[model samples]
Structures are given as structure tokens and as C-alpha cells.
Target: MEVIEVKDQDLASTLSNNSKVVIKYYADWCGSCRLFNPKYKRLAKDERFQDVTFLNINAEHNPEARSKAGVSNLPSFAIVENGEFKETIFTSKEEAVVELLNKLN
Candidate 1:
């Protein structure tokens, strides 16, 4: 599983470079994010999401980028494909993300 850490300055370019990008906006102090971290990492290791690039951005460190993505929640997941915003899934369930990846295929 590969996790890319994104910062504000390189975010746009990083998103543009990948045809499919799965970004998780999280903050260290958020309890929900802490709980979801392991599951999220497991999802990244799954073969189903191999083609999708996984990125983890610290929302607290990049508020501007978080606002740009409209992340009102602590643990937010966004799927961006072809530089276009696709869908967002906000939940602690790993199944939700697995289901979303299945649909993508």
C-alpha cells in the first residue's frame, strides 16, 4: 500500500497528474479519523483499488485545500478521476470504500 502525503502547493498538480485519485482528508486530533485509519490503509492494500492512487492530506495543515474540496467532516474521502471530481464517501466503514471501488470497476 502506497500513501502519498499531499500539501497545499502540490495538490493541484498531483490531482491533475493522476487519472484516478482517492484522497482522504483527515486531521490528527479527529477521533473518527483515528478509528478509520487502519481500515483506510487496508483498503489501499486491496487489489481492487490498485489502480487508484491513494493520498492522505492533513486537513489541519492545509485548511485552504480542505475548504477547496468542501470537506466539512473530519474524515472525508473523495474520488477524483480524469481531473474531475467524482464522488465523496464519508463514513467509518471500510465496506463503503470497498463498495465504491467495486463500482468504479
Candidate 2:
């Protein structure tokens, strides 16, 4: 349940290959993104999310992924299940993320 750093070139392929995927779209300059980093990592390592493929996509560098995920804010979280886009959590709070992951379980 490690988080993979996805680039613009690998975004599509990664999505195509993984069934349950959680992508965190972030920018280096964003303070909120920085703050959310640890939580995101913890989520990836959690046993509950073991089957989920966790990914980190740079919003500025990966426009295609950012647009596909409909990320309008820094540190946006998008979940895809069974090759379909399930939901996008637009909060920086770790609790909200935990809630969403709980729903998946």
C-alpha cells in the first residue's frame, strides 16, 4: 500500500491497470498540500486501504490527471473504484479522508 508518484505520462496507464485507486493531487507551493502529506501517507499504509492503489500527482506538472480528477483545489483527493471514478474529496482534513476510506470498506 505504498504511494506511487505519478507523472503526466504514467497517469492514464496507472488508472487503467489499477482497480481501486486513490490519487492525491497537490502542488509543491501549496501549504495545505504540504500539511496533508503525512495524512495521505498514513492512509496509504493503513491496512484498511491495503488493496487500494495510492498515488501522488503533482497538480502543476500533471495537468491531464488534475483535469481528469476535476481538481480545483490544492490537495484534492479522488477515488476510483473498479475502473470508475467514485468520488472526489475536496477537503484537507484527515477526518474527511478517513470517512471516505471507511465508506470504501
Candidate 3:
């Protein structure tokens, strides 16, 4: 699945509507965030993640969305299941993201 770009207005509903979700919080000025875009896309299309919803929220512009993940880094990942925040990791590594995704399965 392609990553869905979410803003503050749609975050709450999106989380509630999806069963399992992985949100990638980023800032436009962060180099690491930009570099991870393609990798995030590849992971979203991963067969193991077929049942998960992938989301992208700009940390700089969406304070409410960032608060969901307690985002403190340029690239942070959070897993939300059944509209509840589960776990989050602050990382720029692809393997770390895979680790986060593992929690859903």
C-alpha cells in the first residue's frame, strides 16, 4: 500500500478507521526524513504488511499528529492498533522500522 499523507484534522479518524497502522512522522527540512521516503514506500508495499495501513504525517506542521507518537526526532515511527497508540521508535534505519512493523504481526 502507498503511504497516506495525513494532517492533524484527519489523524484521529484515520487511526480509528484502520485496524493496524504504522505512521512515519517527518519534517520537510530533515535530511534523514527525505532519505527514508523510498524505503518507507518499499516497506509499505511489503507482503508481510499487506494488512497494515501506512501513514505519513509532517511533524513540523501537525502538532496533534506528532503528539500521538511523542515524536522528538526527525524520523520517528509509531504503531497504532484499534485507534490506540502501541509503540514508537526514534530511528533513521530501515531495520529499525522493520522491527517496529514486526510488532503489528
Q: What's the number of clashes in each of the models?
A: 0, 0, 0
TM-score of each candidate structure, all chains considered together:
0.89, 0.92, 0.97
Over 1-105, each residue of candidate 1 has an lDDT whose tens digit, in order, gives 688999989889998988888888998899998898888888888897888888899988998678777888878888888877778767767877777666556
List of clashing residue pairs for candidate 1: none
| Model 2 error, position 19 (Å) | 0.9
Let me know the TM-score candidate 2 reaches against the reference structure.
0.92
Q: What order do you get sorting by TM-score, best first?
A: 3, 2, 1
Q: Lowest lDDT 10-mer window, candidate 1?
A: 96-105
lDDT of 2 by residue, 1-105 (tens): 778999989977888898888888899999999998888999899988888898999999988888888989988988887767788878899988888776666
The deviation in Å at residue 55 for candidate 2 is 0.4
lDDT of 1: 0.82
Model 2: worst 10 consecutive residues (lDDT sum): 96-105
lDDT of 3 by residue, 3-90 (tens): 9999999998898899999999999999999999999999999999999999999999999889878999879999999999999899
Model 2 stretches with alpha carbons more than 4 Å out: none
Count residue pairs with overlapping backbones in model 3.
0
Best by lDDT: 3
For all candidates in order, the CA lDDT equals 0.82, 0.86, 0.93
Best by TM-score: 3
Cα-based lDDT at residue 21, candidate 1: 84
